[model samples]
Target: MPSELVFCHPDGGIYGLQFPMSNSISQLDISTMKELSNFVNLLSRHKNLSSIDLEFHRKGDVRAQRIINHAFSLNVQQLTIACLFKKNKKYSHDERVAFPLSLSGSKTLEHLSLRGSCGLFDEEIVLTSAQRFSSLTTLLLHSITLYDGFLSMCPNLKNLTLFSYRMTGSPVLRISHPQLSNLTLEKGECFTHTVNGGRFHVSAPELASLHFFGFCPQMFTTGDGFPCLENAHLSFHSRLECISGSYAPTIVNLLQQFRNVKHLTLSMEIIERLNSSEELISHRPCPLANLKSLTLLPEVATFVQHKHTRVIMSPEVQKYLLSSSPKATLTEVLTLI
Candidate 1:
């Protein structure tokens, strides 16, 4: 009946811990902006505090790094930084906010995520910075640039996602993690591409899931690209530009490259606003063959409904869209809207 006595058998399932402390627990709300530096310092001694998530908004630069560093001292296993920052490219370039990229507090961090800040880091800073997070397995960063450091140093990385991945130069990638299974890429400025003479390689072989938010789906490479991809997600935004040869034409190849993909998540913008007229999509059959799940959000349905908006797929085209792939059987699908 005591919390300390609660345990789970190795071959058995999870066991619930029961608290034995006989005391009235006072409700302390941290959201009220309590000045609890002393309390926080006390909790810092708890070695069991291995995982922590933080969201800071409008809380004017309150020594965030220190709080984070303290959490590491408490054996934090996971750390997520979701800060609110208006677009400030100059500040990111001038100030090394993105520097000290690694966690100095807990050298044993397994997961780290930095998101929701625009223009806080440059491409080179993140790439070549000295890293102490040798135990990291999962990493997610947004509003920053990635360099070769991300690709080369993160040998233990299992899952990676870069939201708003804005890089200036073409960085060499040497990713070869076998445990890597999931990948998610979000929107960012166009990565300044350098002339790549070598082939695109994936050192990882266990990758099974992938999601591209605001991806230029038209990028199709043939040899040794996306060999083990199973599920793919494409999330489109309103401001997303749909160039003819790049995005539109590339759709065929993307569908072809991941020919065996089972699930496909099409963002509303791609499904709806892509065609000047809905009629364009009416004729083209769904390309993916092994697709089993199709998520049609409300936005895509709304885009298909507009009359002057082009050829929206009617029941006839809808049938063709589904039947296009013999293996493209959507067993559990979402017709949102």
Candidate 2:
């Protein structure tokens, strides 16, 4: 038997896999519940599997619970379970209940990613499963809510990624993880439909990398602080109001917050926003004395089409940055319009 098994399915349904008869299997990927059940039953003697990626064929399929139960009980180190939604309907209530219920018993799990259309929240699993995540070091949540104190329960968490989630009304979101080192937030489509809560206040004293893509938060402030941040990447998707004169200052303040960053990546739009006024640059120049490398990403669409094979930066913005951080290496990325 081989140590790894790969199952591929374009749409969905049971698919045949090139299975290895070994019990030392470390990774498994199955497209549908049918295939998953067959493999598990056939390999009944297998108990050393350490990672699994299971995707269900339907939104509310009852068989998904079985996969969750089996996967959770194995205490796999890395697990990703997603029950994709049907055209209009999201997940069934039972499907949603299955995951949290199974997750409550996790003992050896370290990295977990859950992707579903709806109904999964931190609050649902925190109470019973909080203690179970003592070994969890990383988490990725897609289309989930943060209203419940879900994050506070992970004591040893080091990396986190949030996608397609909403945060409303609260004046601030303060995340304080003692060992957290990497944080990425890619705001999904829901960001445009809701009013965002105020500034993001983070307190990861050991944090080293921060990345934000999509809509801009109202404000970005820190608590105990990100004293160890060495890399920062930022990109925005909406039109930033330039006439108000307030946008540039906000950006300057944000940049100043991470003055110690060594490597920085920014979208071309951010530089354009800053170039709107020369006075803004002169008065609030970011003191990036430690900056070693700088990369400017072009428009998202063009960057994707060109496969990021070229670099482009406007002379005006390039000159402004060169003056501020003369010792840092400059990298410009071009995007085809």
* lDDT agreement with native, every candidate: 0.51, 0.62
> lDDT score, residue 54, model 1?
56
Candidate 2 local lDDT, 125-211, one digit each (tens): 211233347788999977654543556766778999877755433445567788999998876434334433235777788889999
Q: Show how many residue pairs clash in every candidate, following the order shown.
A: 11, 6
| Candidate 1 C-alpha lDDT tens digits along 102-189 | 4453467888776555543532224334345667789887765566545555567889887665553443334467778887765533
Segments of candidate 1 deviating more than 4 angstroms: 1-44, 55-62, 85-102, 105-107, 119-132, 168-176, 190-203, 215-223, 236-241, 248-250, 266-289, 293-327, 330-337
